[model samples]
Target: MPGNLKDRRGAGRHPAEALTCFCRDVLTSLGVPDEDAAVVADSLVRANLEGKDSHGISRLPIYAKRIRECRISARPDICIDRDGAVLKVDGGNGLGQVVSYKALQAAFPVARETGIAAVAVRNSNHFGAASYYCQMACREGMALIATTNSPPGIAPWGGKRAYLGTNPVAFGFPTRREPPVIVDMSSSIVARGKIILAAAEGREIPQDWAIDEEGLPTTDAEAALRGAVLPLGGPKGYALAVAVEMLSGVLSGAAFGPHVNNLYKDGDPPANVGHSFILIDVEHLMPLEEYYARLERFIREMKSHPKARGTEEILYPGERSYRTYMNRLREGVTLNPSLKSMLNDIGRACGVNL
Candidate 1:
């Protein structure tokens, strides 16, 4: 857990299924197709299940507002241009989840045929989490490298102005019996969404997370929002963010750098976010069984290493999130008081009982 949210409390617990249904209903009421609504709802709820509450249902209000304002199309005329194993998809201002889902569906068969496939998406809104697409590809016995560019929030290597996004990237590798190895992370020191949540909760942010408008460190969430988030490892994260922008934005023919519209604040223009997906079929390189055995062997050896003091079991990249998902599935998803109120408000507006 991030230090900012460690002290937060929940209002109550609710079934993940129920939250999904409510989100789906709210989206459908706003003219989104039932199937598309379900896809976005499931993606958001799964984030919550995996303990990524920052990208979970907390984002629905902005989505709803955007939908009502005609910024995000209810039914996008998504078009795909294919060239060999590469695909370029134009989202037509559609919801990011729906557009990305369609793109992934298109990539699956191509990967199977060519052993590898690349999909570049443009004119999309904010997709919930990159891991959702990684997990989707992993489920089909494929390794995936996925990335998405968001509205600019992070500064360049030596600049104080916000120019690059906290571009998120995810990698997923399948295992025979163990949970898939999933690594999802942002280029910033912390995700900008976490700061947004802190601001919403009226909490002070860690000084390292972001800076004030004058490029000085501050604990005020609002001030941080007005400034820029720090890169994860300074220049290293800035370089990664540049790479992600190239793949997801420049390569996809979408808005990049500061050109991307903000999802929460910019209401006039559509947020033409971009995403890139690379899928590799395991059997293409070697037999599936052989790959699984090699991967599991590596994992076993790595986990068996001696632990430092106060260290418990050493788990793989996705092990912790996988455990959280399982536990939350059984115990129910918890919502903070503000999130609960927000959802309830959306429910009332959409005529759906939460």
Candidate 2:
């Protein structure tokens, strides 16, 4: 771990404040228009606030390169056209945050009318954690599923050459007034971003997370980057990853496989990333209060169940992150020394100290 691991000082920031800083400094440095930068930055910082470090500020450098290289548009007047409950959004190569946010924002009203709405986006870059948007929909009493695809970072089942991005999927559901149940995960054994972070920190990666260049598993981050990551559960994970690729990348007509430039290598233009978001109004199934009450009961049972002999406690996804978020609220967000330096560089380029 970085020296700051024990120091909660830079653990996390307030959702709103971190959003502003990331937008103003990081995106602005990437040359995005002020307004567009704000949109992109807000979502990224919100990911951090939710304790998703892999999808947070650590992604800024790669996003900036995309912007500076014209792979991502700094100013996109996105076109969101609706076909009944479906929305097709042309992102104009804008930051994924701006495009995805606008698409979901528009989907909200459409879902209200039809009890469900879905949006597909094309020509956009990475949009941070998918749960951030799902959580947004959950706040409105909607069950949401979000997915995004990137350039190929993993090999398909029974295949060698990398042909898929990690391809994350998120599902968010709200029951009554309790905290929403949010599950966000990548189909790959681990996020490529997390591997990059591990490499940067000179930390050893887990062997199962990736394979070496020789097609063997390795615990070395450098070797993993040179190789491919495994699927979550063999064929099942591969199937899910392929599904995401089709829905997000193929449906949106974005790039796929190795043809897409690697975000860390920082060469070549962005592959015109794509994403899809779905929102379902719980009111259509049943009243929100009734659904939530039942959900709360389920949660109570699951959380209060007897513990295994070796296990201390059982936790649903997003539980640990919530604790970190609460603690980090009192302590400032922590940054690795190296990351702090990079942020300073962006600040200097943008002529702002934030």
Q: Pick the candidate with the highest lDDT.
A: 1
Error of model 2, residue 98, in angstroms: 0.8
TM-score of each: 0.96, 0.91
Ten contiguous residues with the weakest lDDT in model 2: 5-14
Runs of candidate 1 exceeding 4 Å displacement: 1-11
- The RMSD of every model to the true structure, in order and in angstroms, is 4.2, 3.7
lDDT of 1 by residue, 33-112 (tens): 99999999999999999999999999999999899999999899999989999999999999999999999999999999
CA lDDT of each candidate? 0.92, 0.78
Model 2 Cα displacement at 226 (Å)? 1.8
